[model samples]
Target: MTDPERELNFAREIIGQRGFRDVPTDEVLGEAERLLNGWMAGDFRMERPKLYDHYALLLLALLQKNRDLEARIEALEARDA
Candidate 1:
């Protein structure tokens, strides 16, 4: 499968294993950042480069979603207060 496809599958697996509200976004983002930086700096070598791309994209998406959710929650709280 292509990198995007693989990343989507990985996301689905993660959500399936841990419900959407329970996902460990912080941990996943941390690992993705470490792997991507290591790959870019030549400190790590992988037989498949696509995996790095996949995780990088996934990390960005997850971060954006987390931020969006947090903003929505803050807005709701402010409205209630």
Candidate 2:
């Protein structure tokens, strides 16, 4: 299972990209929390979107994971430098 906090963060990132313009950070964060909670409880099912939507979600997850890995790598490199 994925870390809950990580899943929440991922949901927030995805929604933010979907456009929550001018919305308060707290509101967005709350939405992410709600979504994460629903998903964890298996109450977040929805109709499938276009193929692009699926791909976009996958790519976002991959990019976020890559970014996290890159940051860790950079930190290690600096420590060893």
Candidate 3:
């Protein structure tokens, strides 16, 4: 089972027009920090400012990921039921 609603909400909140276009600076930095610790720790050159350049791409990828997960969950539920 999966919390599709929660997953969708997270994506929706982030992908909304105002949310994506005018994300809070503090929250943006916080997101980059988490990425730094988990994914870019090995690459010291991937700084926070560089992340801003790819912010839109990152959010779009997140939306795609959410869609994929939703599809996967639906498939599993249909198969099981």
TM-scores vs. true structure, each candidate: 0.45, 0.38, 0.41
Over the stretch 1-81, how does candidate 2's per-residue lDDT look in tens digits?
444443234433446555544544455445545655676686554223432243454454556657878999999999999
lDDT of 3 by residue, 6-81 (tens): 2222323333566554665445445545554544444233434545656664566556667878999999999999
The stretch of ten residues in a row with the least summed lDDT in candidate 2 is 45-54
Which of the two candidates, 2 or 3, achieves a greater lDDT against the reference? 2
Q: Which prediction has more favorable TM-score, 2 or 3?
A: 3
Q: CA lDDT, every prediction?
A: 0.58, 0.53, 0.52
**Better-scoring candidate (lDDT), 1 or 2:** 1
Per-residue lDDT tens digits for candidate 1, residues 8-68, read: 3333333456655565666556655665565567665544645644565466658777898
Which candidate gets the maximum TM-score versus the true structure? 1
Ranking by TM-score: 1, 3, 2
Could you tell me the lDDT of residue 7 within candidate 3? 20
What's every prediction's RMSD, in angstroms? 8.1, 9.2, 14.9
